[model samples]
Target chain A: MKVKTKHIMNLFYIPALLLFVAFVVYPFTQGIRISFTNWNGYSQAYKYIGLDNYIRFFKDKNVLGAFVNTIIYGFGSTIVQNILGLAYALFLNSKFTGRSVVRAVIYMPVMIASLIMGYIMYFLVQYDGGAINDLLILFGKAPVDLMSQGPRAVLIMTLINILQFVGISMVIYLAGLQNIPEMYYEAASIDGVNAWGQFKYITLPLLMPAISSAVVLNLIGGLKLFDIIMALTAGGPGYSTHSLSTMVTNMYFRGQHAGYSATIGIFTFIFIMIVSNIIVRYFDKKEVEM
Target chain B: MVQNNKRAAIWRTPLAIIIVLIHFAPIYILLGMAFKSPKDVTSRWILPGYIYKQNFDIAINKGNMLAGLYNTTIITVSCIVLIIVFGALAAYPLARNRSKFNGGIKAFVLGIMMVPPLSILVPLYTVMAGLKGTSTYWGIIVILTAFQLPMSIFLYTNFISAIPTALDEAASIDGCGPFRTFFLVILPQLKPITASVVILTGINCWNDYQFSLYMLQSPKIKTITLTISSFFSQNSNNVNAAAAAALMGILPVILLFLSLQKYFIKGMVDSAIK
Candidate 1:
């Protein structure tokens, strides 16, 4: 009877599973099938071109560029975001006056839509009468067009993302810090441990869960960056700043290559899975050691 | 050591104020841009001495912001309610049942989180178009709920797991079936987590772009982000008006975040580490 009741309870999840099937799983399988065909996205008629789309992607320079940019966007921002966030968390956790106000100010950006924030940030980076250029002009320096270059534009976008979302990591760490009882710190003090020693020996090890959560969250987010790229570059300045996410969109919408787009999509899905799994496993091992 | 820390705090306060100003600069530029006339091609750093009301006027009329607001509100509210209900409902059994099958279900849900919306953009758009779901409120709501459900379920699962099973056992002994036991016993206890889910998922649904871009392509059905994007695309020259529209987009969220400051911060933290 108990087992039967439990099975009945399990049935409650069927609606959610069905929705996932209809939206995510079904479309995902369809994407794989479409990747083999020469469908231009709109028309029903097309031929199965088997592995050619994948072959083209492997040989394509744009795909290579986008792949590299995606990694840079992912790991680059995650490294900076986590370190900076941990620092801010440490500083604010010490109960300074206006700490709440400071935290709120930093967090304000995360509330704005990324698409809109991208547009807003563009105001500062725009060439004529822009904020950065105005400062350069203050020192009588020639105004440089920031977004016109590829590597420079990519770095700026990564910095923008880190600045915007760093508050999230800080607050996560703040909570983790609070969870550690004051007694631990007091005991460390009695043992004559220095501040750095206490942090190294006592605080860092205990905050492992929060650290993993912040790092993984930032990594996954950075990997899937799309809206900001759309608003800022539109995968433009000659496809140099495109992430895989934006690349997929541009392929389908502008280049009229639905089949090829689906192939790249599959690549992105698998790549994210492998990378995130590796990161998760790495953290899992560290967690066990701690 | 305590005395040294206090002295350090005095120096840190000024540094903290500088950080706050730097973080707040974009919004300052945005505010300046929105209130300035187009003829005033001054640096974005300079604030307009007087209000320029025409920018907001142009944004509203040209950007279709009123329709966008209405459509976004309907979609956001409906998606939030569905995500909360479905996410919480789905999490209940997965939290309670320690079976291998249920464990696999939980992992699959987590896997769904890693699939970027753009990766599935092609087939998902094709499927929605086939279903005549393009430009429809119900269509976008369903899609948004599905994408946003995983985080909510993850939070709810951890939350429900911490809940004592003794309550369920007691309810079952009192002649309550699984459904009744859940409704009567487990559901009320979920108020705190539900608050977190609402803030977290609510923000996502409100700020969603990719799904809404494809699903709600019609101008009449455009959300705030779509409307603003279209406005920008139409005229790169219309910086002031676009700034106004973008300001409009940022205001509701900023105001909500300020009012519900605790929940917003707590929701962000809970969704991550807790």
Candidate 2:
């Protein structure tokens, strides 16, 4: 009877497993295969280029620039966004009126699509007739070229992302805050612990799970950042803000070495997998400790 | 002491409100731009006293915004339905049984979630093109479902595991088969999580631009995001018209989120914390 029941369970799982292998597994294998070929993204006639594409990618200045910019953007966005988000979360977690309204308002930017946010920011940051410039003129100060400059353009984009996505980290922190028992704070207070002391010992330690999640999410998002870059500057002013994802897409569409673009994509995928696994494992261990 | 506490509370409340206002200023700018005329948009800081219907009218008429709306609705709804159905069905055995196979399957799905969509974009595009699925609604729908499956399965598996197996046993003893047991016994218990899955997946499908841009080239099959992008590219000078189009594009998603805010918030928090 138990054997029959096991057979029935296997029957139920077979179809789903097949679909998984076909849709998820097959394409991943095919993607790896395509990375080795000189396929022009359309034709089947192409040679196996061996490690040449990977080698060429290393020598390419644009590819190197994209790599550097992507890392900088990812690191910058993750650190700034998390810090700001945590600060905001702590502020709201305090005893206050209109906390719910505050949360709703803070989360508003996150609700809008990134592309729309990018377009809106473009108008706001443009040199002439932009909202920022207009405000600057009103203040009797010279307007700075936000999108035309090199590193500053990327900085401005990162700042916009920080403002938009800080709400996600804040919400996660709020969840972490709720999970901590009030007794800890009360006990600390009895031992002559001030507010900062209680926060340092109780809040910081207990908030590790949320912090871990926020870090993982922000890192992944920042690394894969493309939509906003596409809309904001189109990786513009000579690819100053070009991310790996955007560069891969541009190269593929521009019809200049599809295999090389695939190689870049493969490298990015492996890099993300490594970083994410490290973060997830580290956090999982920490969660077990807590 | 009482006076000091009151003063602190007063200061904190106003400060929090100011922070919230600053955070939401971008959305207010979007709304403001949507209502301003093209000329008024040049001086964006100043409030426009009147609604500029011309931009909205032009965006709809010239941009074929209605067609884009139809395309977005069809794709989002279709993809959401597939994700819920297929994801729940796939998650059942993993949740019910405790074995290496089931554990392996669960791990595989989780691993797929980490692979960024950009990594698979080129190959997936090729596959769709070869199958002659590009430039069609079904193509985008299929790609959306495939990409969204891992996360949806993760969510469904987590939710389904919380359900007791005794329900399945009871149904089986009553002569119910596995399929019947899932639909009648287990699926009803999945409503709350299903609501969460629908809202999250629905919002994602509605807002996706990359897949649509790469897969669909025909204007007839364009989704709202694609249409909005094309509109902006074509009419770079018409800021009000662009803003109006953007507003129209996101209205459905915003309304959906607003109406289901409670469920959406709970679902998101629950999924993350889990």
Question: Would candidate 2 be rated incorrect, acceptable, medium or high by CAPRI criteria?
Answer: medium
Question: Total backbone clashes of model 1?
Answer: 0
Candidate 2 local lDDT, B55-121, one digit each (tens): 8998999988999999999998999988888888888877877689789878887787787778777
Instruction: Give DockQ: model 1.
Output: 0.82
Question: What lDDT does candidate 2 reach at residue A71?
Answer: 83
After the best TM-score superposition of candidate 2, give how far the Cα of residue B67 lies from its true spot, in angstroms.
1.1
Error of 2 at A246 (Å): 0.5
Candidate 1 per-residue lDDT, tens place, A138-248, comes to 899999999999999999999999988998898998999988889999999999998899999889999999999999899988998888899999877999999999999
Lowest-scoring 10 consecutive residues by lDDT in candidate 2 chain A? A10-19
The candidate that achieves the highest lDDT relative to the unseen native structure? 1
| lDDT scores of the candidates, listed in order | 0.91, 0.81
Show pairs that collide, candidate 2: none
lDDT of 1 by residue, B101-176 (tens): 9999999998888888889999999989989988999899989999999998999999999999999999989999
